[model samples]
Target: MQIEIKSLLKSCGVTSIMVTHDQEEALSMADRIVVLNKGRIEQIDTPDALYDAPASLFVNGFIGHANFLKGRTSPQPGTIALDAGCALALAGTAPPPAHRDVMVSIRPENLALVSDAQPRSIAVTIRVVMPLGAFSVIDCVTASGEAIKVSQSRAAWSGRPGDAAWLMIQDISKVHVFEATTASPSIARA
Candidate 1:
């Protein structure tokens, strides 16, 4: 039914406004998106831009599944000391916020599992593994007790709870940092 509606609009070359609460629906059907937070515009951009470079923490969480970790400014510029037990080296897309309290977010699929010896890796203990055929959703915890999630190929989901492992950010560009705000730490789950 959704596809039919979209097709009808497209076939007639009609410009239509769609108001939806379904993020996936909006993402798939719109050429551009305007995200609102509490009735205020948070960001206006193409879907790719909204997902890749969210203007703020709220936009980042609203657009997709994100792993939020508490982080802080390190002594070094552009470096964040994650409470998850590692330092995150950003891609230099933008300067780190001046505030000491910041949050780091990355999609689960963007995280890579590596040997515990890897540098800049976040130490986590495997909590649960949900196999989704081609891939698996892994729930884990940092030594400091922050919950983390990783998406990996099912064949590679071999770690048990006590197994030594670390998470590597595959592309620093995929990492988003924002000044920690009083806003809720997580998106409302359905």
Candidate 2:
């Protein structure tokens, strides 16, 4: 119905503005999106641009399911030292300035459960599991008490709550960094 309405609006050459709470609907139907929080404009951009390059932590957390880790920029380029006592190298782009506090954001779908310890792997305790047909949502908590969520295909994962596992990022390019204090506009990428 929404798709049909959108198509009709487009075919009639009429500019339409829709206010919707459904993220998927907004993403699918709109040519441009303006995300508002507490009556203030958070960010405005095309759907893909908004999802791939959210300007603030609120926008990042609001637009999609994201796992956030508190960390500080490492002395090494393209790296951050997580408060969990591990380091993660920012992939595909230059790292934030050294010694700066940052919040690392990675979408749940981009994370994978690993069996062996590997580079940028973090140990977590599975706290909950939710099955959703083709995929399952796994909730995990790190040693540092930070919560993380993973969305994986049912066939790919077969773990239960209370299980200990290693979580690894499959793609470094999907990592997003924001200033810890203000969730400022994305600076590392653009």
lDDT string, candidate 2, 1-190, tens digits: 9889889999999998999988899999999999987789989999999999888888887785678888999788988988866798777866568999998888999999875677679988899989999999999999999889999998888888998888988888889998786543232122
Task: Write down the lDDT of every candidate, Cα atoms only.
Answer: 0.83, 0.85
Cand. 1 Cα-lDDT: 0.83
Residue 97 lDDT (model 1): 59
Cα RMSD to the true fold for all candidates:
1.9, 4.0
Q: Please write out the lDDT profile of model 1 over residues 1-190, one tens digit for every residue.
A: 7789889998999999888889999898888899988789999999899999888888898997899999898777788888888888787666465448988888998997775658788888888878888998988888888888899898876777666678988889889888887876575223
lDDT of candidate model 2 versus the reference = 0.85
Best by lDDT: 2
Question: Which pairs clash in the backbone of model 1?
Answer: none
